[model samples]
Target: MARVKRNPMRGGNKFKLGVFGANADGCLSITRHPDRWMADWDDVLAAAQMSDRAGLDFFLPLARWKGFGGETNARHISYETFTFAAALSGLTEQIALFATVHTLIVPPVYAAKALVTLDHASHGRAGLNMVCGWNQPEFDMFGLTKPDQVYDQGREWFEILRRTLAGDAAFDFKGEFFDLKGVEGAPGPVQQPHPVTLSAAFSPPGRDFAAGSCDCIFTTFTTYDDAKVTIADFQSRVDKAGRQAGIFAPVHVVCRPTEQEARDYYQDYAVTRTDDAAVDQHMAMKKNMSGSHDPAAYDLYRKRFAGGAGSYPLIGTPEQIAEEMIGLNNLGFGGLAMSFVNPKYELPWFLDRLLPLLEKAGLRI
Candidate 1:
């Protein structure tokens, strides 16, 4: 393997790491497997504690209102993101907690206050993972209008949030989606200006929006070369604007002592027991709601729920998984977040087995 050079940015680490989907049931995998752990508070807390103790960087929960229909009823159970973040903040000593916000649902005024609420609980460790709504049915659950141009509305929503958190004196603003008059922003958040912000956007326009709007861009990639190209493009945009943004990749790990053991489990769980019906439901939703003409292009999206909605897989032994992380570090990825079938048991297992290799490889401190 090539020597992985740690990122040299003043505040950047070798690579940032976090846990995704621990706060939702089943980790988005539609299966009735015995190993699946419900992402209840106990489950999420266990994972959060392990990640914090292991010095991982962040925890992101997917926002879900309803579950896709299947025998498993995947992701039907969910914790509200801000409340989940607030609870995790008090329970753990470190590790940033990001509340995933469906920007359209919450007004910027209240959203700003809720963010501050978590920031106080975490003493500045709170952040936002803003997502434009993707599932039409999910939005229908809230009676929200499924806009013809969702990302544009998302841009407007973010602008309102951006200005609201800036906390300038009374201001008035009107936009296509939002209108505010004499809005006095909230007073203080522990983080300077505000807490960190992230957005999961993979398409070209979405990538540009993430690069220009957030401190970090969260995305899922299928290949290293593709990710390298996309990351370069996104960072170039951010750099041209005289700002720097981190690109956090999501990966799904199904590792064991040996590669075959891991592959067998993934093969059995992801393929043989794959929920094709549920996967199709999700894929159709993505194409219809996001206005993407080519949802099928996402290989993993078609492949059963690999890790919390098609995050890249690191399915191998601990050594192989560590090597994968090292390769991502070398490729200039800012961070990685992932999910597991059973985080309560598997998270500690991963930390115990993989943290040493990561440290040895110089990917973690």
Candidate 2:
């Protein structure tokens, strides 16, 4: 309902870059290694600065209500995303600040107001990523139960928030999950008509929700070839729905001087010296929530557990890794979101060394 003229992340760049979940516990690397762990003010602010100076486009955080228990307590103590984004907005420039929220937990009226406030704090640089509640234990902790129809509930939640942000007159809405009475958000978002919104949806209903309600969509693929089919189909679906949205691919990147070096880094950090307890707990929760119908689906998520939580691994020389992302660009991917184990240590190298190569290839500005 809000008028979105041009996507901030896609203003001129064909393939934009964003930092995913770096503000929350290494984005699920599930390790205790100090090098790869994060969730402190200094670490988060530093990474945001690097992304800002390096011309990265956005910083998206995870909304983890609870952690997967292990020696490390994976994702156990995440800083709240909304507050984090609001605070970080004061320290950075250019890069968008994204706060993730669980639709089941955040009341639509309050959630809409919070987003508008953050957009003002960022001077119109705020965005939202919405997720249906998963992790049954996480819900139980909040004295709640997982909804029977998660996507349907989320769809209703999104509609309420959308109208709350865009409506010119006082409005009342009644949906399956929400009911509002003569309420309107005032001093609307700094970004006319509202800040960017994103949804991470894969199934048919989920994809349809994204097509109709979001300015961006976050998703993943098993491989680059698989991406061509998936991205094209999703794009067509969005077009048919009369919405032009960007689908940003999520991936784990291990770029070094050579393929062997990259493999060695991945093996040392994410595999060989992996945090077994955390991985097991994470995998169990994923399996319980996912209900993987086929063996193929199970194997795929199982591998994602071992890797960095379902992100396609881009491991090789810097140039090789850049080229791999370029391939996603070829597949019609609007952009890429990265989850790094040691973003503070590694992201600068990407900006200094790898980004130039990508720019030369015409993937970035």
Query: Each prediction's Cα RMSD?
Result: 4.7, 3.2
lDDT of 1 by residue, 41-103 (tens): 776787888887787778888888887766666778888999999988878877888899887
Go through the candidates in order and give each one's C-alpha lDDT: 0.75, 0.77
Error of 1 at 147 (Å): 2.7
lDDT of 2 by residue, 202-236 (tens): 66666777887788778767766767777777788
Scored against the true structure, residue 108 in model 2 reaches a CA lDDT of 82
- Stretches > 4 Å off in candidate 1: 1-12, 291-301, 304-308
